[model samples]
Target: MIVSRSPVGEIATALAANGLILRGGFNFCDDEAAPAAGSAAPAKSVLLVGQAGAAPWPHFQRWLERQSARIVNPLDTWSCEVIGAVAQEFGARAVSPSDRPYLPFQQWAMRAEGVKPSPLGILMHPQYGLWHAYRGALLFEEEVSLPEAHAANHLCDTCVERPCLKSCPVDAYSGQGFAHEACLDHVRGPRGAPCRSGGCLDRSACPYGAEYRYPADVQAFHMAAFAAL
Candidate 1:
């Protein structure tokens, strides 16, 4: 027996080849979505591509090893290559989180997935916890049929301890907000060796979805990038 293929399934296959997942999507015609770039004729839908946990780390590492020269923002560059190919194949536009004039990715994610922010400001996933990220998106000129997004219970709401709020040595996160400078300074200082080698203490402290937490190496890479910024 053979199963018929669908546009969504085909796209998901392409992304999965590179260890990316279609987080979710929404049609611009849905009214709640902000109009696409072109006013006269805008893209009708968006499919977000991202990773859960360290699923993409091995794939990204292999791609990184093949680069002839040092590449800046290597992960982002690779995401564009992979997602751009799929976009071209589907006649869609590819956009990145790093794009200037910053697309409202967070807003779009909430609309598409019904996810809420964790204490660290990263959107919390019911299953993935703090262990996921939005790599890029595919914007189609015509509407695509997509299943409706269901709201998941917010993980933080039920937790009583709230370890993420108390783990940071500098108290970088609080009711006020993240202290960017403080967090940065600590990650770059002598005492920050643990965090630099592992990951953000506050982030790792989150007890929810411990199994989905990123590996130390993956976390270290991101920490280094953050410290450099």
Candidate 2:
């Protein structure tokens, strides 16, 4: 049984219904993706999907948790289920960050949307700052014409204060790179309360996209995840 190829607009609309944005996409001439099992054709393009900020996510995640109670790797399972369904509907292959031999999400983000890492090593979205994330990607066998790569202005370059460097209580991020042990230890200790409750001071200090800052509860959720790691 053959399925009809979905238009990009329809795909984007379908994703939006789930509070996921079709962040950006690219087409490859030489096929960046290796052929999936039993497939002769390699993926000719990829579309990035992600959440911009905390919102419907809290609600979505809550609903997901209930449905995923029996699942071991819920996020990845959910990502695959959600994205994979869309891919199956649209004649594309779905993959996620959890995939083995992990897809180059960072490389793809850079090339597709001109995204760069902030001091926190998270992709510094021009509008969303550190609050955005790439959840999954759709790999298509058909060669879709790509949009011009975004030329993101370097928000960090012009800021003289560079508050992100000094804001860390443990000085975890800087020219020395992330001091993983130092950060983890502190967050697991008593002195980490403010950070544990309010999210990373370094990340919050950034002036860009302040309006998009995740709420404290949302921040706490991520902070706990970081602590667990």
Query: Clashes per prediction?
Result: 0, 0
What's the lDDT for all of these models?
0.86, 0.78
| Model 1 spans > 4 angstroms off | 1-6, 30-40
Cα-based TM-score, every candidate: 0.93, 0.89
Q: Write the per-residue lDDT of candidate 1 for residues 51-85, one digit (tens) a residue.
A: 88888888889999999999879989999999999
Candidate 2: residue pairs that collide: none
Q: Estimate candidate 1's alpha-carbon lDDT, on a 0 to 1 scale.
A: 0.86
